[model samples]
Every structure is written in C-alpha cells, then in structure tokens.
Target: MDIVEFLSERISEDEAVARTLLGDRTVSKSGAWYEQRLLLECEAKRRLIRIVESARQAALAAMVSTPDQDVGWIPQSLQWMEQSLNALALPYYDHPDFDQDWFRT
Candidate 1:
C-alpha cells in the first residue's frame, strides 16, 4: 500500500490492538492519539531535516564559482517542505479507551 494508506492501516491496527488488550476504556483514545501524534511529528521532523540538508547542499553548490541551474528549486522545495512540516505538527485530538474484558465480550 502507499505510505499514507499504510500509515492509516497501521494506526487502525494499533487502535485495534489497544482496544483488544484493554477493552475500550476512557483513556484508550488518549493513548492512541498521543502515539499517532508523536509518530507523525517524528516523521515530519525527519522529512524536514532531509529537506533542509538538501537545501543546504544545493545552496552551497550555488555559492561556488559555477552554480548548477537546478539551484533555483531549493527555495521552493524548502517552502513546500516547511508547509508540510507545519501541517503535520498540528495537534490531533481524540481520546478513547477500552477495557481488556471488552475484547472478550
């Protein structure tokens, strides 16, 4: 599956696991939401870091005596990646919990 779909499926699976293990408690959603939020932030941070590194390299290349024509895309790429980072950093709120017995029931 594509990355987005895969991520969604994995999140769903984790929710299922949590619910199965703990039976829909009041805190289940909180735990799952926190976990997913953290994962998304981490992924976004990693992607932004990569984009920054690439931009730095491209900027350095452009500073040299003979700059590559492709250096023009560096700023635009950074902007786009920054927007993505911001989007991912937004807080997601949802909290639900399940009891272990809920699974057996």
Candidate 2:
C-alpha cells in the first residue's frame, strides 16, 4: 500500500517485539525505530524513483516528438525535466568523504 502505512506497520511490529523482550532501555527502541525508518525510507524511495523515471521518460518523449514546439507547454515540460533531474540527483548531492576528483574523468 502507501509508504507511510507500510513503514509504520513494519516499525510497529518491530517495536512490539522489542518491547516484549528488551524491557525499555534509555534509548527505548529509538535506535531500532530509526534504523527501521531508514530502511523503509530507502525502499519507498526506490519505488518512487521508478515511478518518477517512467514519468520523466514519457515527458521527454512528448517534448521531443510534439509539433507545436512554440507553445506554453514547452516551459512546463522544461520544468518537469528539471524537477525530475533534481529529484534523481538528490542522492548524490552530498557526500562528506567523496572528493570532487572522484567524480571527474
């Protein structure tokens, strides 16, 4: 189903099991919850990336093959392209240890 529901269901299940055994430390499942959240987030993001990529490809095809290139839809199409690029670029935008030279040819 939805990402939030999937994440919450998994996390709640984990927490319930943890509570039955761990007896509540100071962290009290915070670490486990965070880890689970991160895992779920990654999974959700993967699905989202696939969906966005499909839409981006469709938009690109439309932008390339359309006859009326001088219409207002061009700007909207450009905006979609930029947004899709930015969304896909987010994962690589920051890396504390990755030097710029590593990315250069």
> Which one wins on TM-score?
2
Reference-based TM-score of each model: 0.38, 0.47
Candidate no. 1 TM-score: 0.38
Per-residue lDDT, model 2, residue 82, is: 49
How far is each candidate from the true structure, as Cα RMSD in Å? 14.7, 9.6
lDDT top scorer: 2
> What tens-digit string does per-residue lDDT give for candidate 2 at 1-105?
432243344445545655544444655477657655655665565576566557667777777788577545655765664465344334443535323432331
Give the clashing pairs for model 2.
none
| Candidate 1 lDDT by residue in tens digits, 41-105 | 55555565566557656766665745645556656765664445334323221213222222222
Q: After superposition on all CA atoms, how large is the RMSD of candidate 2?
A: 9.6
